[model samples]
Target: MGGLIFIFVQVLVAVFLCINFMLITTFFTKEFFYTTMRYILFAVTLLSDCVILIVTNLLIICNYLKITMNLWLCAIMFILSTVYSSVTPFTLTAMTLERYVAICMPLRHGDLCSTRCSLHCILLIHGLSSIHFIVDLSIYFASTSIKFYKQSMICNVWIFILYRWQDHLRNAIKTLYFLFMCITIVFSYVRIMKAARAASGEDRKSTWKGLKTVILHAFQLLLCLIQLWCPLIESAVLQTNVKAYINLRYVNYIIFYVASRCLSPLIYGLRDEKFFCAMKSYLLCGFYKKKNVI
Candidate 1:
C-alpha cells in the first residue's frame, strides 16, 4: 500500500510539474509575457509551485523508504519545502493585487505594475517567505546542541520541533502570515467586484474576469492554509484508527498540497485565452506549425 501511494504521488507530481514547466517555458519564450505584470506573477507562482512539489515529494519519498540522514541535511530539506510552500500563497496574494490594480485602478496599473516592479515583487515574495524559515532555524540552533546536528534522523519537519512551545510558535506565526495574505486577497476581490458592477461593455467583462481570478486565488489560498492543519488532522485520525489515518494522510496530501499547486496552471495557463493559445502552440509545435501552414 505504501509503495502504491508513493507511485500515485510521483505520477501526480510528474503531471503537474510537466504542465507547469511548459507554461513557464511559454512565458519565457514570449517576450510579451515577460513585460506583462500579470503573466510575470503567474510565472513566478508556477516556478514556486514546482519547487514546492519537488521538495515535498522528495521528503515524502525519503519517509516512505525510511531513509535517514544527518539532522542538518534533513533541516535543509524541510526548510526548503517550508519556504517554497509559503511562497505560493504570497505569490497568489500578489497576483490578486495585480488583478485588483488592473481592474479597479486601470489607469494607474501600468505605472504600478511595471516589469521592474514585478521582478521586485517576486524578490520580495521570496525574501518574505524565507523569514519564517530563518526564525525557525534560529530557534532550532539555539535549542539544540551542536552534536545533535550530526545525528541521523528521518527527514521530517517534526524533527525540528525541539519543544512543544516551538510548534505553538510556528503555528502562531503561520496564522498571522496567512491572515495578512487572506485580508489582502479579500480586499482585492471586494474592490474588483465593485469595479465590475460599476463598469460596462469590455471593461465590465474584464473586471468580471479579474474578479473570478481573485476568487480562484482565494480558493488556492484556502487550500494552502488547510495544509497547515493536515498534520493535526492526521494525528486525530491516528488516535482513532491507524488504517483510517493512513488513508486520510494520503488524501490530505493530494487534495491540499498537490491539488492546490495544480490551480496556478489551470487558472492562468489554460483558462486565459491568450496564454492558452501560446501554450498550446508550444505544446503542439509540429501540429500547430503544420496547421498554420495549411
Candidate 2:
C-alpha cells in the first residue's frame, strides 16, 4: 500500500514539474526577457526546483523498484536537496531586495536592479548558500560510514538529514544556514512592506502595486520555507516521541514537493499578466493569438 501511494504521488509530482518546466521555459522566450534580471532569477528558482523534482522522482521510482542506491548517488540526492533549500531563500531575499528598492528607493532602483547588479546578486547568493554546505558535506562524509545507507535502498535525502545532527560540523552548518536565510528573508520583506506603508501622494498608486506584489511573493516564499523545514521537523518529532508514525516523513516530502513546485508558480507567477499570457501562448503552440502588452 505504501509503495502504491508513493508511485501515485510520483506520477502526480512528475506531471506538475513538467508543467512548471513549460511555464519556466516560456519565461525565457524573447518577450519575457524585457525584464531581464527579474526573469533570470525567476528562471533560476524554477530550474532549481526542476533539479529537486527530478531527483525526488528518481529516488521514489528507485524505492518502488527496491533498487539500492550507492552512497554517491544518495549523497548527490542529499546535496541537491540542500542546494535547492538554500537557493530558495537566497533568491527570495534578492527578489525582495529588488522590490524594496523599486518601492522604497525608487531613485536608485534602476542602477540597483540593473542586469549586472542582478547577476552579481545571483553569484553572491549561490556562493553564500553553498559554502557551508560544502563544509558540512566534507565533514559528514569524512567521519560517517555509509555502508548501511548503500544497503537500505531508502533513496531519500531525509536519510542524510537524520544523520547530520550527530556530526557537530554539519549540525552547526545546518542550523546556522537555515537561521540566517530565514532571517534575511523575513527582514527583507518587513523592510519592503514598511516602505510601502510609508508612501505618499505622488507614489501612492505605484507603492500599492508594489506592496501587493511583495505580499504575493512573500506568501509563496513562506510556503516554500515551511516545506523546506518539514524534513527537519519530522526528524525532531521522531526523536522525541517513539509513538510518532514513521509514515509522516513521506507525508512531509510529498506535501512539500507538491506545494513548492505546483502551487508556487500558479499563485505568484500568475500575477504578471505578460508572463501569464506568454505561458498561454507557449502551451497553445502559436495557434493562439498573442495578446498585446498595452
Candidate 3:
C-alpha cells in the first residue's frame, strides 16, 4: 500500500510538472507575454511552483528510499523549498493588486503595471520571501551546535528546528504573514466588487471577471495557508493511530502541497483566454496550423 501510494504521488507530481513546464514554455517563447504585467507575474508564479514541487518531491523520494543527506545540504534544499513556498503567496498578492489596479483604476493600470514595475514586484516578492529563510538561518546558527551541521540525517524541516521556541516562532510568523496577505486580498476583492457595481457594458464584464479572479486568489491563498497546520494535524493523528496517520499524511500532502500549486496555473493560465489560446497552440503545435489550412 505504501509503495502504491508513493507511486501515485510521483505520477501526480510528474503530471503537474509537465503542465507547468508547458505553460512556462508558452510564456517565454512568445514576446506578447513579456510585455504584459499579468502574464509576467503568472510566469513567475509557475516557475516558483515548479521549483517547490521538484524540491518537495525529491525530499519525499529521498525519505522513502531511506537515503540520508548531510545536514548542511539538507538545510540548503529546505531553504529553497521554504523560500519558494513563500514566493507563491507574495506573488499571488502582487497579482491580486495588479487586477485591482486594472479594474478599479484602469487609467493608471498601464503606468503602475509596466514591465519594469512588474519585474520590480518580482524582485520584491523574492526579497520578502527570503526574510523568513534569513531569520531562520540566523536562529539556527545561534541556537544550534556546529557539530550537527556535519551529521547525516533525513532532510526534513523539523531537523533544523532544534528548539521548541523555534516552532512557536514559526507559527507566530506564519499567522501574521497569512493575516497580512488575507487583508490585502480582501481589500482588492472589495474594491473590485465596487468597480463591478459601477461599471457597465464591457467595463462591467471585465470588472466582474477581475472580481472573480481575486476571489480565486483568496481561495488559493487559503489553501496555501492551510499547509501550516498539516504537521500539527498529522502529529495528532499519529498519536491516535499510526495507520490512519500514514494515510492522512499522504492525503494532506497531495491536497495542500501538490493541489494548491495547481491552482495558480489553472487560475491564470487556463482561464485567461489569450494565454490559453497561445498555450493550446504551443501544446498542439502544427495541429492548429493544419486545421487553419483546411
Sort every candidate by lDDT, greatest first. Answer: 3, 1, 2
Q: What is the lDDT of residue 239 in candidate 3?
A: 97
- Per-residue lDDT tens digits for candidate 3, residues 20-136, read 998898898789899999999999999999999899999989988989999888988989998999999889989999999888788999899999999899989898888777878
| Superposed Cα deviation of residue 165, candidate 1 (Å) | 1.6
Candidate 1 stretches greater than 4 Å from native: 286-294
What are the candidates' C-alpha RMSDs?
Answer: 2.4, 4.8, 2.5
Per-residue lDDT of 1-294 in model 2, one digit per residue for the tens?
Answer: 566677678778778788777777787776546466666777777777788778777776786677887777787777786677667657765776677777777799888888888788878878876765576566666767767545645666545443544445545665676567567656766776676677778676666666666666666566665664665677688888644534565677677666655655764468666678778767776554454332
- On TM-score, the stronger of 1 and 2 is 1
Report the Cα lDDT for residue 19, model 1: 87
Candidate 1 positional error at 15, Å: 1.0
Least well predicted 10-residue stretch by lDDT in candidate 1: 158-167
lDDT of each: 0.87, 0.68, 0.89
Best by lDDT: 3
**Residue range 68-108, candidate 1, lDDT tens digits:** 88887888787888888888899899989988888878799
